[model samples]
Target: MSNPAPAEAPTGAGTAPVPHRDTEEPAFPAAADRSQWRYRPRRAFWRSRVVRAVAVVTVLAICALFILGLVREQTGTEGFLVGLGLAVLPVPLLMAAFRWLDRVEPGPWKNLLFAFAWGAFAAALVAILANSFAVRWIATATADPDSADTLGATVIAPVVEESAKAAAILLLFLFRRKHFGGLVDGVVIAGFTATGFAFTENILYLGNAFGEDQEFGSTGLGSVTAATFFVRVVMSPFAHPLFTVLTGIGFGFAALAPRGKRLRRVLLPLAGLLLAMGLHAAWNGSATFGGPLAFYAVYGALMVPAFGLLTWLAVWSRQRELRTISGELPAYAAAGWLSPAEPTALSSMRARQVARAFAARTYGPAAARAVGEYESFATTLAFLRDRARRGTAGPDFPAREQELLHHLWQRREVASPALTYAARATGRVWAPPQYLDYDGYNPYRR
Candidate 1:
């Protein structure tokens, strides 16, 4: 240009060429579009094939030991079958309850699988062997087997069983930090672990009850098995989950604690475990205090109130999680990275379901799958941004954010339009005509 003497780049036979002026950058450059970036997945230290294989084998061995121990304790094949059938009745109900609590930010199935397996196998085996040994030793020392049984139930069993179950939660919390984010995560994991423990414990109690009934020539609902079923299965199926949930609350608090609050993080879970042990002791001692009537009294006076309080807290926490998601996502939308209606639509479970349905109806199963994946990634991004704002984000925050953003960008072609239709159908107002005209049609805006 300075050479102006460059003659403005001479024209060809049928073409005209002009001297180049200063080039302005595009508003959305290809380099800035992360969807085009080549993603090199990083290998996690603990996800090595060898480590996973070893973990699988270890869980299997523990499950085998638990099964063998249960058989030995039951003494009859028929009794075991009866216990198995009765004991499984409450599992589905309990699992569904926890799953409902986790609807706001559902954790990975793999994490739940590990929690359940640990509870069913490793925790159960440890509790059984430890409690049996301690009870036998106490009986021999006291020379009073009846008193030993009472002491074992009130003291040794609670300590051993709760500690074993808490171990599983702790392992998952430490290893699966991304999933162990808040109070609901803690509650759900603890619930499943306790459920597994309860399942094994129930089998033992019901089986033994069945054996006693058989020995006494009793049958039908009036039998010892019936009484045990009413007490354990009907009356107090939530007993184990209730106690263990305290420990879970502690872990949940720890998970939300800031990175610098090292002392709080360490103390909270221990406090919870101690509280669980205390509650367990109180419940077990109720029977000794005044027999079954004392059990019923405590159930009404203490346990029921505690359960209601926890249920309310879980529900409240779920609402808070939804609020966080709704509040944080609009910034990205304003920055031209998401559709205007995405934050509101994602905040409502109803809207999400509608979006998925609309996608499936309009664009087939693959599009519906993409919509689901988009919802999950968006939820995760919301949580990550919230953590960053609170100064609790991990070292890899930027990388994780970029990765999630890339995933959302890639799926936006299919998911964004579906979500827009869902929002309109769900009654959210569309963008004004002026705004729409100004923005034009940018399908990849997100």
Candidate 2:
């Protein structure tokens, strides 16, 4: 298809002349004329983002200090050191897996970091205190500490811990709504939160186990420490993440629902929370119900299947996001906002990587960074338009669209040629016949 004709610049007093281009049309108005599209928030000093950020950081810092003190107190110095070392083994792997799933439209690291911190410190503190209080109350009322502990593990712990972890998801959903978009976003955030929770919990379990080993004078593979390591680290590092991801999927579907459908939005997440609690309860009760046989049965029959299904759903949803980008961006392409090949090229991760590599090789790292930013802006634009079409976008849709278009326009000179080259190299789309003649060809000219 032929490129769209450049839009005629509007004539008016005080307007700067639009710069001339030989090959491509400007996507929107000239940068100098976009004052109308800018958004400037007007808030009091106390309500400003900097103030709010400081407040949040302070609260989280306090929570971190308290939780660290509590864990260290219980584990003792030597046991705590051993537990910290062992518990950290699975964190990187889990974080990497969740991050890989988020490659299509990655959210800010700050959001993920906040989720992890919330889980590790705030959520853990809440679960420990609440669960301990409830169990003590139950034991006092029923005069049976053993049954109270059993009830706490099966019923109270699930409710408290899942709710605590879900608090991080809820906060992100309510406040950082932009980043908590779809299934994968929800899954990744929940995974991080749960990973953090598991990290702290593993330290406690492994530390207590080490203490038990010291008490029993055992120092080898057959000791309590080795068993705890095998069970918590190797056998089921994904346990907590699996449970929390159910709740995340619920929130994901809720995010996709229209704003007018309040009941559906609320009910979806509640249902997911209930499912998460049920699964968690079952897993916790497995030993009490039927020992190793029951634990293995639940792991094999329920957890494994659920994990596999969720993994498939997450992968399928990611692929669907790419398809959405390719499908939606062509309209902008036809309107001169993007080159004809970009929609297709941006749809493939391979092409995007190739584009960045080509830019780095041809024009240095800054150009590669520009190309990456262009891809991100383009993806955000596609999602915004899709949300608008579905009647789920917020009131700032027009302003946001303009902003994204401006960013894409700024980087297109460097990004476009690299993407075009990537498209050609990957055989996603061929160069136009007029541009194929090497005698007059200039790939970097746009």
Best by TM-score: 2
Q: What is the C-alpha lDDT of each candidate?
A: 0.81, 0.86
Would you list the clashing residue pairs of candidate 2? none
- Give per-residue CA lDDT, model 1, range 267-379, as digits (tens): 99999999999999999999877887898899899999999999999998899898988988886676556778899889888888998998898789999999999999999
lDDT of 2: 0.86
Clashing pairs in 1: none
Q: Looking at model 1, report the run of 10 residues with the lowest lDDT sum.
A: 4-13
Instruction: At residue 285, give the lDDT of candidate 2.
Output: 94
Question: What ranges in model 1 sit over 4 Å off?
Answer: 1-50, 428-446
**Candidate 2, TM-score vs. the true structure?**
0.91
Question: What CA RMSD would you report for each candidate?
Answer: 10.3, 5.8
